[model samples]
Target: MSFTLEFFATPEIPEVLKECLRVLKKDGRLCVVAMNQKDDPTLMIKLYEWAHRKFPTFVDCRPIFVRKTLEESCFPVLDSVEIFAWGLPIEVVLSKICKENSKRS
Candidate 1:
C-alpha cells in the first residue's frame, strides 16, 4: 500500500507504475491514497494544478485520475472510494495484480 507517494514522484504515474508492475509479485495487490480529480470539480483540480505549478517544491502533488491511470497501467481497480480532506477530494484505490504481467519472459 502506498500513502500519498505516487503523486509526489516527478515521473508520470503510468511510467512509474510500469516499473512497479515489472517488480510486483503475482497476485500482489496495490493500494493507493491520492488526491483525485475523479469526483471533484474541474476548477478545484485546476487550482491544485496551479498550486503545483506555482510552488512545485511546496505542493509536490497534484490531483490525478486514479482509476484511469491504474487501469491504463494494467492494474485493474478492484475498489475505489473518494474522501475529502479540508474540502479537497482524495481517493483510496485498491487494485488487483495482473498475473499475466507479473513475470517477464
Candidate 2:
C-alpha cells in the first residue's frame, strides 16, 4: 500500500501517522511533502511563514520535526528530498511501515 500527503500541515501529524499505519499493510510506503525551514531564514521563507500563519490549515512543520514524529509513530524513513515548490523550499519524505515488533512508542 502507498499514500501521499501534500499541500497542508497540521499539528496532529503523529496522530495522522498512526492512522496511516493502522490501515497500511506490512511494508507499505508513505510519502509526505511539507514546507521546509532553513537555518538562515530567507525572505521567501519569512513570507511563507507569515502567509501560513494567516491560515489555520498551514502548520509550517520543519523536516526534522516531521522525521522525528514519523519515527515516533513507527514509520522508518527510507528517503528524503529537499526541493523548491513555488520558490519555497519543501521536504519530501518517504517512510515505510515498520515490522510489528519495532512498532512501539
Candidate 3:
C-alpha cells in the first residue's frame, strides 16, 4: 500500500510517524520534512517562541525534541542528515496560523 501525508508548518511527526508505521505494509518507506534551524535560525526561534507563548500547555516547540520523539517512538533510522538551503528565507514561508495564533495570545 502507498500513502502520502503532508504537514503544514512544523508538526509533531513522532506520533504521525508511528501512525504511518501502524498503517503501512512491510518494506514501506516514510519521508519527512520540517522547518529546521538551518532554514533560518531567527525565524525558527521566533516560530518556536511564538508556539510556546501561544500554546504553553504542550512542550514540543523544539526541533531536537521532535527528533528525540521520533527516536523514542521506535522509528527506524536508516539515514539522518541535516540540510541547509541558502538563498531562501523562511520568514516568507512562515504560516499565517502561527502568526495569527501567536498574535492572539
**Candidate 3 TM-score, true structure as reference:** 0.42
TM-score, cand. 2: 0.67
lDDT of 2 by residue, 20-70 (tens): 987776667888766655678778777766775686366534333446667
Look at candidate 2 and give me any clashing residue pairs: none
TM-score of model 1 vs. true structure: 0.77
Candidate 1 residue pairs in clash (backbone atoms < 3 Å):
none
CA error at residue 27 for candidate 3, angstroms: 1.8
Candidate 1's residue-wise lDDT over 3-74, tens digit each?
A: 455554535667778777877777778888888765546676777779889998897877777787788789
Q: Residue 76 in candidate 2 has what lDDT?
A: 87
Evaluated against the true structure, the overall lDDT of model 1 is 0.75
Off by over 4 Å in 3: 1-14, 37-66, 85-105
Q: Distance (Å) between predicted and true CA of 75, model 2? A: 1.2
* lDDT of residue 67 for candidate 1: 81
**Per-prediction tally of clashes:** 0, 0, 0
Root-mean-square deviation of every model? 2.9, 4.7, 14.3
- The best candidate by lDDT is 1
